[model samples]
Target: MIYQIYPRSFQDSGDDGVGDLRGITARLPYVASLGVGAVWLSPIFTSPMRDFGYDVADYCDIDPLFGTLDDFDALVAEAHRLGLKVMLDYVPNHTSSDHAWFRESLTGKESGKRDWYVWRDPAQDGGVPNNWKSFFGGPAWTLDEASGQYYLHQFLPSQPDLNWRNPAVRAAMFDVLRFWMRRGVDGFRVDVIWLLAEDEDFRDEPVNPDWKPGDVEHASLDHIHTQDQPETHEYIREMRRVLDEFDDRMMVGEIYLPVVKLLPYAGTAEEPMVHLPFNFHLILQGWTAELVRGFADSYDAECRLRHSWPNWVLGNHDQHRFKSRLGADQYRVAQTLLLTLRGTPTVYYGDEIGMTDVDVPADRLVDPAALQQPDSPEAGRDPERTPMQWDATANAGFAPGGATPWLPLADDYPAVNVAAQDGDPASDLNYFRALTRLRAEYPALVGGAYRSLETPGADVFAYERMPEHGGGERVVVLLNFGGEAADVAGLAGGDTLLSSLGDRPERGAALRPHEARILRG
Candidate 1:
């Protein structure tokens, strides 16, 4: 299992209200003890924190707020000792406005690095260069009086898009990759892999007739010529080359496109780009059994035909927690599906403890996207960025002196904190530990081929994971998403190997609402 740890929210060892590298190092044993094979850390580089750490100011050093390079080195060493691989978030598309390259480009029109970013002149009518909108809202281009040119930023203005078309920029980004690879880091979670390029000509995007305010503001128009450009693959290949230097290192991309569009990002098995272009269908699509089946079948078929490995994710920092999205009971079913599905499964931090998104007031909001449109439903990512709850103590034991958290602690944390459930066999945290242990013990569950199994009820989702040889173990996973009980008659003879709801009622019996079962034949 791949556990995703958002460093700023994991643990604050110094009681400074923000989690740091030292905090992560101190927590590595907990992560390893949970049976996760690797941990994907969000960006920890020097940044202005305008968009949190997404807007990177320096690629080579750790931010002072997150601790120093030595702290990070210790984190890597400790994680390695614990047998946990470290995957750092690679923000290659943009940099903080304060980054040296952006600073130089913003110096003036005569600066040598003026072309380092996507800068365009005003249109003939004095309007912004194009109709492209930022993900945070408003026009994508921001004017700089010092340079007398508008710089493009797909997200926030503080994060100006880098000119990937520039050879120097590409080389510098590659060097950044090399820097991490030399640090004994295992891999990277490449952020915004789709937004690496845009149309060379500054053309206006056609209006999206389906545009709605709460939906992603950048999706207002068809991104045909703007994103998911052909050039992205070439860059990904170069990234793969850097990773290939270290044996067993992996690269996972954050591609938010539909299943059909995600195929190319994985490349052919012969010349793979990313080890896995994250499978986000579970998070983006409806949770009904039919929808899940369709997505799984389509994705499985595509992977088989293309010879690319599959990856799955149900929750992440950007979206609502799985528990919030599916509720307590259904969340268990979702967890079963994630653990049993083919490919590497990524679990968001605090997910094992069943953490839900906490409501963040406008005054407490820190994400730039939410701050830009504070009053709207786009309350930004503050809810998901809250600190992890370790115990019922003040500040949930996330910091030393029980200070105010960087983000608000969850309301139900007292009842749901890790300490409350760690020893409880019925707890979601224990269930996750058991599930990961099961996956580790059985190759069929982790690196096996998936086959969907037919079930009587539409609410009941069932699938079989089989190992390479028919002689290997075969496990059937069943999930009931609806409120009513479900009859899973197809698996009448298999032994109940593991289940979210302890003890099987008998063969060919009914399952409770939101029940999840794993049977072996």
Candidate 2:
């Protein structure tokens, strides 16, 4: 299992309200004890915090808010000592406006670093050079009065897009990766891997006539040439070269594309660009037997055909928690699928304890997106960024003293905190431990061939995982999505190995609503 830790919400050691590397190091044992193979940390680099840490201001240094470079080294050392591989979040497509490169580029056109960023002259109509819109709901190009040109920012204006076409920019970014590798980081979680390159000619994208209200405004355009350019693969190759210097260092890309489009990003089996291009179909598709089966089969087939590894994620800070979307009971079913899937699974921090998103009022919001458009439902990521509840103590024991949290603290934390449930065998935390232990003990569950099982219920999603050699154990995992008992047939003889709800004998077993069962055949 791959545990994903959002630094801002994990723990706050200094009682500064914000979590830091020191806080993470303090919790290493707790994380390692969970049996997770690796921990993927969200961006903790120097940033202006416009989009939190996504807008990197300094790639090689740690943000003071998160602690210093020394703290990061110590965290890496501690994580390695605990047998947990550490992966840093790598943001290559853009940088914070305060970054040295961007600051130098914005000084004037005569600056040597002018070409480091993507800048274009104003159009005849004095509007943006192109018809591209930012993902945060505005024109992609931001006018710089000092340079008399508009710099492109795909997400937020504070995050100016980098000029990947520039050889010097590519070299600088590569050097940044090497710096982290030398520091003993195991791998990287590359952010927005598909948005590395844009159209060279600065052509306007055609508007989608089928565009309707309520859809993401950025999706209104076909995105014909703004992103996913052919040149991205070459850049990825260069990145792979840097990672090749270190042994067992992996690279996972965040490619928000369909299965067919995502396949190419992983490259061929012999020469893989990315170790894993994250599969997000499960997160996007509604929970249904047919939808789940179709997505899982297609994704598995594509990965197998390409000889590329697969990675799955159900919850991240960017989206609502799985329990919140799937309902409290359905979380167990989702966890079963995540653990039993063919790929390496990523579990967001607090997901193991069944944490839900807390509500953040407009005035209390810290995210820039929510501040920019309060009327929109995009209340930003404040809800998901709330502090983790470690115990029922004051401030959920996230910090020593009772201090105001960086984000709104969860109200139900007193009853759902980790300390409250750690002793209970039926707790979600314990269930997660059992699930992770099962994955570690069974090769068929971790590195096995996946085949969908056709069961006799609309809410029941079942799949068989078979080992490659030496007895070739077969584990059948079944999940009930609906809030009703699901009769799982055709598995009467097998031994019931694990169940999310509780232990049950194998028979014409009826799965409770949102229950999951793993049978060993």
- Top candidate (lDDT): 2
How many clashes (backbone N, Cα, C below 3 Å) per candidate?
Answer: 0, 0
lDDT of 1: 0.86
Question: Please, what are the lDDT tens digits per residue for candidate 2 over residues 141-189?
Answer: 9999877899999989999999999999999999988999999999999
Model 1: lowest-lDDT 10 consecutive positions:
371-380
Q: lDDT of all the models against the reference? A: 0.86, 0.87
Model 1: per-residue lDDT, tens digit, 181-231? 899889999999988988888688887899777776776887776788888
Please report, as a residue range, the 10-residue window in candidate 2 with the lowest summed lDDT: 370-379
